[model samples]
Structure formats: structure tokens, C-alpha cells
Target: MKRLLALTLALLPTLATAGQITLILSDKIETSDGKICLYENAVKSEQVKVTASAQCRHTMTFED
Candidate 1:
């Protein structure tokens, strides 16, 4: 429960930079390293909703 809260808190800041969100569920615990790819959704939403995956292009890498 605490981990979920922490993750939520961490992701909230990302929303400030953009409208939608990407809930990256990784195999490894650490989210601050390479081997991870970040992408923006091609189709955006008009109404309020949540999605799992998006038609994305290979965007920039995440840096620590």
C-alpha cells in the first residue's frame, strides 16, 4: 500500500508537465536507469479516462 502511494506521488509530478500519464510497470523495481523507453501517446483523449498502452514512437531515454 505504501509503495503504491509512493509511486502515485512520484507520477503526479509528471502530470504537471503533460496532460496524460504513462504508468510504467517494469520487471525490475528500480525506475531510474537504462533499458527503459518513454513515449507519448499519438491519440490523445478529449474526455477523462485511463489507458494501458498507446501507439507510440521511440522517444528519448530516461536519465538518472
Candidate 2:
């Protein structure tokens, strides 16, 4: 299937640049200001940056 092979080759770049972020509830702790906050699992990715905590009860995935 030449067409299928061509299609797959055309999509290779998109797939290579695409990425996902996974956040999982790690802990609940108090801040210095006496406020409660949620902490999520640490994410290490050069393409994604997490600036805030996650308040989800389950795992979450975000694609871009």
C-alpha cells in the first residue's frame, strides 16, 4: 500500500512533536500562609511546564 506508507510518513513529524502531560495527586500540604494546597506528581519535560498544582482526584493527561 503505497498510499498508506506515504500517509504514515507524512504524519511522522506530527507524532514526533506531539507530547502529553500526566498529573497525579501526590499530596496535600499547608503553605506558609496557612493555606491548604494540592501537590501533583513531578513532571519532567522540556516541552511542557506546569505552573500550578492539580486538584484532581485521579490521574489526568493533556496532549498538545
Candidate 3:
């Protein structure tokens, strides 16, 4: 059981990055507004609950 658990834990990072999801950040939104620090810059991460929008941009990345 320990070996299996260890394997699953090790694989978690790869699985989490496998699925693609876009986190759109905006400055005008009132709810779910926050900042995400990446590299050396701090950018605002906002809530986007709508199914469709024209101003949102897609951010994508992968993990090992």
C-alpha cells in the first residue's frame, strides 16, 4: 500500500498539469479578484464565470 500511495503522490503533479484550463484575469471584475505572481511580475487574476467572453485571454502550461 505504501508503494502504491507513493506512486500516486508522485504522479499527481503530472496529472494536474495534463488537463488544460484557462485562468482569465481581468481588472474590471468585482468578484474573485486577485493577483498571481509569476516570474517577477504581479498580475491580477479575476473571476470569469460566464461561458463566453470576448476580452479574455488563454494561459496554458504543463508539469512533469
Candidate 4:
């Protein structure tokens, strides 16, 4: 178990940033509109309520 734990620990960071994800927030925002918010490896929430035009973009890269 020790070796497995060590291996997992060593690879945790690499695995964490192994992929790229993009989030595109629309320019049109409204209480009835829905937006995507990502947290960690998956979406934290959906159908965000907003009241105005908003645009956002996010990108992440991994390096050894």
C-alpha cells in the first residue's frame, strides 16, 4: 500500500492538469438564462441566474 500511495501522490499533480477545459460565458445574461461553471474536474453548477450582458473565457495548461 505504501508504494501505491507514493505512486498516486507523485502522479496527483500531473493528473490534476492532464487535460484542458474551456468555459465560454455568453454575452447575454438573464435570470432565465443558464451558464456553465466548472470546479475541479467537473461542472460545479448549472443554470446560473444573471441580469446583464457578460462574457468570460478561461483556459489552463499543464507543464512538467
Candidate 5:
């Protein structure tokens, strides 16, 4: 998680001037009770939602 965050931070400067940048990170995990949990970043695009599982998603949008 730290690495992911670091990577995202590292890329921010480059992407800042690149118009709009959308970063999506997702992960699926099973809880202690054996329940499948989905985590994802909130996105309004149906296309993204349909293509990506919400099993731990982190979405970050940046615009220049």
C-alpha cells in the first residue's frame, strides 16, 4: 500500500501537466469471516465499473 501511494505521488508531477489523469487501484480480499469483500475507488463511468471489480479500488483523478 505504501508503495502504491508512493508511486502515485511520484507520478503526480508528470501527470499534472498531462491534461486529465485517472488512476485506479483495486484489490480483492477475504475477511476473517470468509466473506469476499470488494474495494474500489468511486467512479461515475459505467464502463470503468463494468470492466473493473470494486474489490479494493482507489481512484484518483488529476487535471492540469
Candidate 6:
């Protein structure tokens, strides 16, 4: 049982992922000015949520 537990623990990382996060989806909205709004220069370690992953840009927009 102990060996089995150790094996599971050791193989856990292989089963999952490491370093950086997996971006599931993103949001891309068009501005009224006919410009495409994009997400970029996100703060350090920030996560953005979007309804449609395909439309998202996998980035974050910060207010200057």
C-alpha cells in the first residue's frame, strides 16, 4: 500500500501539468469605434474569464 501511494504521488505530476496556466478560452469584443478590443499586458499572474474561449485573446487589458 505504501509503495502504491508513493507511485501515485510520483506519477501525479505526469498525469497533470506544471508551470504557467492553461487558458481555456477568451473574450474578444468589438468596440463601437469599429476597433477590435484586445486583451494584452495583463498584470502579473492574473486570470481573465470569458464566455467564449474562441473569441478571447488570452490576455488582460489594464487601464492606464
Candidate with maximal TM-score:
2
lDDT of 4 by residue, 1-64 (tens): 9999999999999787766443333333334564443323355222333333543334322232
Whole-model lDDT per candidate: 0.40, 0.52, 0.44, 0.45, 0.50, 0.47
lDDT of 5: 0.50
Model 6 RMSD in angstroms: 8.9
Off by over 4 Å in 4: 21-64
How do the candidates rank by lDDT, highest first? 2, 5, 6, 4, 3, 1
lDDT tens digits by residue: candidate 5, 1-64: 9999999999999776677656554544455544333333454221133223333335646442
Per-residue alpha-carbon lDDT of candidate 1 for residues 1-64, written as tens digits (9 for 90 to 100): 9999999999987866664344333222223332333333453222222233432233332222
Top-scoring candidate (lDDT): 2
**Between prediction 4 and prediction 5, which has the larger TM-score?**
4
State each candidate's clash count: 0, 0, 0, 0, 8, 3
What TM-score would you give candidate 3 relative to the actual structure?
Answer: 0.31
Model 6 per-residue lDDT tens digits across residues 1-64: 9999999999999666544443322334545433343443333333444443234454433423
- Every model's TM-score: 0.28, 0.32, 0.31, 0.31, 0.28, 0.27
lDDT of 2 at 41: 54
Candidate 3 lDDT, 1-64, residue by residue in tens: 9999999999999787675444433333323443332211143333443322333334423221
- Candidate 4 scores a C-alpha RMSD against the true structure in Å of 8.6
Off by over 4 Å in 5: 19-64
Off by over 4 Å in 2: 1-17, 29-39, 42-55
